[model samples]
Target: MTLDPPSTVSTTSRRGTATAATRVLGVLTIVMIGWLGVFGLLLSPADRDQGDAVRIMYVHVPSVWLAYLAFIVTALASAVHLFGKSHSMQADRVAGASAEIGVVFMAVTLVTGMLWGRITWGVYWQWDARLTTTALLFISYIGYLAVRGLEGSRSQRARRSAIVGLLAVLEVPLVHWSVRLWRSLHQEATVLGTDLDVSLDGLMLFSLFVGVVAFTLLFLWLLLHRSRVLTMIDLSAETGLDAALAQRRAEGGVTA
Candidate 1:
């Protein structure tokens, strides 16, 4: 039996329902992010040395946090898709969603790192260990996503992407330790570093915390939408393939 795609009205209703549910959360996200920006920009005291340039931390730090968070999620989803008895398509959708989000955030991290670098290091880019590993991490996931686009069965695509995703995750730890591993202009970790000897003051730290929270919520919302879209796209592709095959079979029967 050929299963048609949902009627436009049905699709619209579902989308409307999703929008309504996310509406309140979206508003809160915006409000919190706006407040964080204002607080970081206007109220927070500047660093004695970097002065106003330090304002970039609110965005850059959150970007890195969310980027790492997204990749971790992708790796988990990929693992489930690969190893679970059911080998669920749902897991694949989730992995794709998180990878897409991760790539965007990683790109943002790179760009902001460059801008921040220009201010603190007097250059937009350098051969620093952290910067180099971070760039590799970004490119590796880009390849992960690219693998999904290759011609193959659903299972085949999932298998390849799963392996790529799992391997790509190793870079996260390396990037995190790049500072401690080698002398780099990039500052060592604030929260994860062994030393509590951090430089961020109370207000600056608070703003950064707010940034992470806000971006995490944003990632959740976006991930929900992205996964749903990926599911629909896969379903549509499968349906079209089925329909074409059915049509060809019918034609051959008539010809015989």
Candidate 2:
């Protein structure tokens, strides 16, 4: 037997809450992004070692963090679908949204990294452990999206894609640990590590933090919009099915 649709009141309230949250987050994101742009681009002191080119860190680091955050959300949503059974469609929708955003951010990270590498290492690309593994991680998720798109049924597709999502998450740890595990040109974690180099300084760190916050808010806003679009598509499909069934019944009645 088919399950009944969710209560209109409950769905409406949830939609309203999501909309408000999206708006608030969008405004906060804009403000934080503006603040970061000014401080990182205009106010932060140039690095003694890398000179003016070091400013790229302000964009590169934040994009990597945002990409990681998106993948984490995708993994969580995939887990919810695999276990909970309920809201599987919603979870899949969220996973899809996060994956798309994650891919974009990952691309930014790679491009920015390449530019930084050219300036410092005198090469556009390197097969260093950290860079190689991170590139592999991004490619793996892109494959997941390709598989998800080709599937037919929502439930079947979700189950298959969720498994891929869960497996792809293993790469996250590998990417994070690659630098420590092997001798690489890439630097270690700056903000969270105990090394505490004073080169970043308080203002630079604060600006980077603001950029992170902005990117996070922007991710949420994008997720909410994508989720709403998915919900609407589902609703449309249901409406179409109902109309088709009604039409079939009407024709049968006329024949009788």
Q: What TM-score, computed on C-alpha atoms, does each candidate reach?
A: 0.90, 0.86
The Cα local distance difference test for each model comes to 0.84, 0.81
Clashes of 2: 0
In model 1, which range of ten residues has the least summed lDDT? 1-10
lDDT of 1 by residue, 157-194 (tens): 99889889888998999999999999987888986787
Alpha-carbon RMSD to native, per candidate: 4.0, 4.7
Q: Give the Cα error of residue 173 in candidate 1, in Å.
A: 0.7
* Model 1 residue 229 distance off true place after TM-score fit, in angstroms: 0.5
Best by TM-score: 1
What local lDDT score does residue 84 receive in model 2, on the 0 to 100 scale?
A: 91
Model 1 TM-score relative to the real fold: 0.90
Local accuracy of candidate 2 as per-residue lDDT tens digits, 1-256: 1122233514335543244456677888889889888988899878778887877888898898989988988899999989994857888888888888899999999999999999988998989999999999989989989978874887888888888988998899889878888898898878755465544677778878888888888887777776666666677788788888888989888532
